[model samples]
Target: MGTSVGPSAGLSPKYQRLIQRTLRIERQPKLELQNERQQKKNTKSLVSDLDGKLSSLQSQLSTLTDTTSSPFDGRNASAAEGTEGFSVSADETASTGSYSLAVNRLASEDGRVSQTFDADKSNLSDFFTNNGAQTFSVDVSTPTDSNPDARTSIDVTVDSDGTNNKEVLSDIQSAIDSAFQSAVDDGTLSADQRPSASVINPTSGTARLSLRSQQTGYQGRLSFSDSSNNLLSELQVNADQIADDTQGGEITEVGTDEASSKLTSEFELNGLTFTRNSNEVTDAVDGVTMNLEEANGTASSFEVTADEEGAQSVVKNFVDRVNEVITFLNEKTNVNPENGERGELADDSTFRRLSRQLRTDATRPVEGQPEGLNTLADIGIEANRDGTLKLTDEDALRTAVRENQGALKDLFAGPDGVATRMKERVDQYADTGGLLDSRQDSIDSSIDRIDDRINGLDERLQRREQQLREQYAEVESTIRSLASQQQSISQRLF
Candidate 1:
């Protein structure tokens, strides 16, 4: 057979080379698989860290939402029971009894009564007797013609040469204008306070400056004086002259004895006032006391006891809290700070379901009320399309709070009230073994097991790689020894 030196003889070398190359490639894939497994482990750890932070934030948000949205605040029925459907009587008053009755009235300033009728003999006599020797200074100058057709007029100037006399007319006008502006700004000025100022220059060349005080029964006239207290102007009159002037004059009624009362029950504890036959109460005068009478001819002895303000405040605070919760949830669940992306919580099935449940709870009807009392709509609270609460009608809310406070209380304080229900639900989900806790625990356990498995795999892979390296080294040594023998033989043969 001549030692069969065919292709089979060379195939051994090629087959060994192929096996070595295949081993190298297979080792590379094992290393790559190890890297991929490690990368997966790192990703899982990152997800766990993020989930922990998110769970913590959600817990905090849940606490805040519960605190701010508590429907139990101001739900106490004590104040309502004491205030509603109650009538008070002034006859129940004792001289020193510590009795308090809330009366509704208009708020006004305090001041002297408005003056009227300056021509009465007794009034004029009293005015001049007490106001004699009061002086005023008058300086009249010829008016420069602004219009040619207009009659020649006289102008009055005060201390024209003195340093303090600069723009005296302008200063006076400014003062008057400022006073009017102030009255307008205060929102309390009445018609009686709208007084006008005028400067008169009689043909006698005497310039008279007068301030007609907006008051009734003026017992004295005004006196004008110089800076040095010297009398500048005064009206001289005897008792006989005053009496004759009073007798000759027409009886003019300048002011009336109208009673002014305002009703302030809506806004404040202050009672309303009734002004008899006159609108003087609307004047800008401060602290003018008219009779404080009720519209029904009764004394100010009405008692309106209700928790209206407190209830409304509670509802408002609750609505505000709920909105805050919504905002917080939206931020936490949907928004990603890095990429500006929405978070898992933003449209989370659990969160949306809970929000809808809360809304239904809030708007649920009161028990024993056939017409379905105590809805959010009744108190002017409306829900937006985004599942948030809004206050739309403040007046209507106030009225509902005032009138149906009991129903309002029951709506939130009843067995199925929003507060109670929310507390139960939140507590259930937030408990140690609750939904969030269970999920987190499960994830933690999974991570722990995965870490254990990865650690075991790492140990096994290290041992396997060491053993494979030793085996390859032994194989290379044997192969190299055999090749050396073959080379030596060939060299000897050559």
Candidate 2:
């Protein structure tokens, strides 16, 4: 029942060698696993970059295809040909301009006077009020026959102190000037637009500030009040009368042809008066009503409506967008960046083919049209010597757009449009079953296999490490037994 002494006292050299060999095997697999993991990471990164590039190219190609097939530029030949029967002249009604507006200032229920101008009828009170209460009031009006110089007065009263008063007045003046300038800038008003406001005083007082219209016939009155309905009433004299008295008509151009003509012409919108000779046209019998010049020719009878202008602008923008897309694609594929390299998709045969295809698709002829109307060239979009398209004849293009609008819309906007075709092509190359998709699939599969292999290697390495430890422990025990046996034999011999 007693425990016997073992011959092995310590680990033998043979057992140590066996343990070392097992450890070497275990470490070998771990090193291999590390290398495999690094390789996997590098491979994944490479695949990811490639995938991104592929996706980008696919998107670009899709966009190009869509644009190429889009109805934006595509027109039905028959529709284009039909447009030849109609003619549009720039001198026609399209060239004529007219605006109608009504302006008036009324005392609000609270005794605050509010002014409104134009069709939408914007209230000047909004510009000068807070919470629907006027903080200050301005009176710009021309005097009656009793006060010939009354038009020269514009009384501004500031209920608030500090820069707010000055700022508000300045803003009002600016707004008035801007309104007049806008008409001139848009070519709707002549340079002789008669009214111009002049600030008399910039400080707070009775008639603290005033604006005088440049013309004598411009006799309009305005009144200002605060939110509390308190009136800061002031009188303004006719500027012409004032000038005649002070400078003997030297500053007054009332009788001149320019002034007279300006006075006679008024802006009307939908039969409503908007402005007359640069002054807000009003219904009051006090002011003279001016007549517009009659159109001189039959062509002048035709009018270019807002809708027509909008359509023309839309077409132009579409063409510009197409040109931009073409330029972008060309630069990406053909031109090298400043760094002396092309895009990822550069030098790709597919991209080159796609570009050519897009061009071809864009320029393809439609059926059922006259020879001249078969291609974009008939409508004035001609191919340049450099292979790009340009609008050589704007009139022809416009006519085509007007006459064959439906056909043109179909060609570019229909299901078979250049944009649609381009999108299909790009999607084919970039989709799950596309060229890039196949490559990605292969790479993914390889990654999966590699991962599985690494996993197996990991498990094998762990098992081998554990086995080595166990073997080393056993070897140490055997050596201890051997040493004990040797010691007992030695003692017995002695």
User: Which candidate leads in TM-score?
Assistant: 1
Give the winner by lDDT. 2
Off by over 4 Å in 2: 1-47, 58-208, 211-234, 237-419, 428-460
Residue-level lDDT of model 1, residues 70-182, one tens digit each, is 32233221212334322322211111112222323322321111112232124323433444422232211111258312211112122221122112222333444455445
> Residue 135 lDDT in model 2?
34
167 in model 1: Cα distance from truth in Å? Answer: 74
Q: What is the lDDT of residue 475 in candidate 2?
A: 61
* Model 1 lDDT, full chain set: 0.41
The number of clashing residue pairs in model 1 is: 42
Which portions of model 1 show Cα errors greater than 4 Å? Answer: 1-317, 320-356, 363-366, 369-372
- Alpha-carbon lDDT of model 2: 0.43
- Model 1: worst 10 consecutive residues (lDDT sum): 233-242
Q: TM-score of predicted model 1?
A: 0.38
- In angstroms, the error of model 1 at 139 is 78
